[model samples]
Target chain A: AQSVAQPEDQVNVAEGNPLTVKCTYSVSGNPYLFWYVQYPNRGLQFLLKYITGDNLVKGSYGFEAEFNKSQTSFHLKKPSALVSDSALYFCAVRDEYGDSSYKLIFGSGTRLLVRP
Target chain B: SAVISQKPSRDICQRGTSLTIQCQVDSQVTMMFWYRQQPGQSLTLIATANQGSEATYESGFVIDKFPISRPNLTFSTLTVSNMSPEDSSIYLCSGTGHYFDNEQFFGPGTRLTVL
Candidate 1:
């Protein structure tokens, strides 16, 4: 089974400060982890993914995520937080080898609030 | 990247009525997916829509309650039947990318409010 866990329900960060949203996962095989952001009343937008690559992956809006295989964690990061970055973030995982490869298991989601 | 569009961005229906949501993709895809998100909840996969085959629904979801149709490689529809207050949620549709990794691109989603 492939599952993702986002421990924080909400994270607050001051403007221009670095922010991190924690995510962890469990999968039978190699994990294909993804990060998505959903604004108010909007659909989810893909941020970045970690399939097989460097531990640090950069994404849109100057956002990045660190994939630490040792910790089984893929935490989303931002160098400088902005008010416009406030939104709901979701972490998802997909199994590398399985009949249910197309299916994605999502986390509970984390709300990021950037204070001005 | 795939461009996906959904019809009737939002709707309000009575308890006994049914509503059908349409999803159209600009690019051809082998698999399309339908998801649901209730208020303050994460997205849950409702079913997988594949061309020329019956939609495969996830656990706790039935075909009779949420019938799906994949008429072609680029279009699919999900109809919510016998609606109730519990059915009020945002229904989303997505298409898998052509790449082997199968990244997904999503539609804006349809918000249904059952009264």
Candidate 2:
């Protein structure tokens, strides 16, 4: 079964420093990875997605992710964290094998805390 | 990206009562899904709402407990049947573009509190 794993429960960083949220996946075939952000009392918002090309996929709100195939990881990163960027992040994956339905398997999620 | 919205942003209902949450998309879509997000947990797929067809529910979920309806390409509904305190969670509706097969956009979600 295709699944996603986010090792960190929470990540704390300074407002001006860089931030990284780790994500790894296990799938049968080529993986379709995605990153989503959730604000308080809001739905999960699509940030970025990696389907075929381009390992470095940039997303909304100045966020980007690197898809490392060898390591089976798609880590979300930002050059400089902002206090408003603090929110919950979820990594999801779907294998491009037999299933054509858009069903996504999500990770446990990581809470981002950016201190001003 | 398609804009999605859910009715009754938050509601408190009694146990055993059922609540039907409506999902309306600004534009037509080919795929619509319902998800549940428990407190302090990740989102879990509840079912896939197919237009003019029975919903395809994920494992550990059934059609009776969470019946879904997709009247058209831009409208869907998820009814939490025989609600209990365990059903108290945020129910979200999401969909992808008609022809685009990239990312799925989500609605604000309906926060249901069963008392």
| Model 1 lDDT tens row, A1-116 | 77899999999999999999999999989988899999988888999999887999898999999999989999999999999999999999988886753788899999999999
Query: Which tens-of-lDDT digit does each residue in B1-115 have in candidate 1?
Result: 8889999899999999999999999988767999999865799999999788889999999999999999898999999999999999999999884453567888999999999
TM-scores (chain A) of the candidates: 0.97, 0.98
Error of 1 at A70 (Å): 1.1
**Per-residue lDDT for A1-116 in model 2, tens only?**
88899999999999999999999999999999999999999999999999989899999999999999999999999999999999999999989894788788999999999999
What are the candidates' individual DockQ scores? 0.72, 0.77
Query: With candidate 2 superimposed using the best TM-score fit, by how many Å does residue B42's alpha carbon deviate from the native?
Result: 0.3
- Real A-B contacts recovered, model 2: 0.70
lDDT of 2 at B52: 99
Tens digit of per-residue lDDT, candidate 2, span B26-107: 9999899999998657999999999999999999999999999999999999999999999999999999853656689999
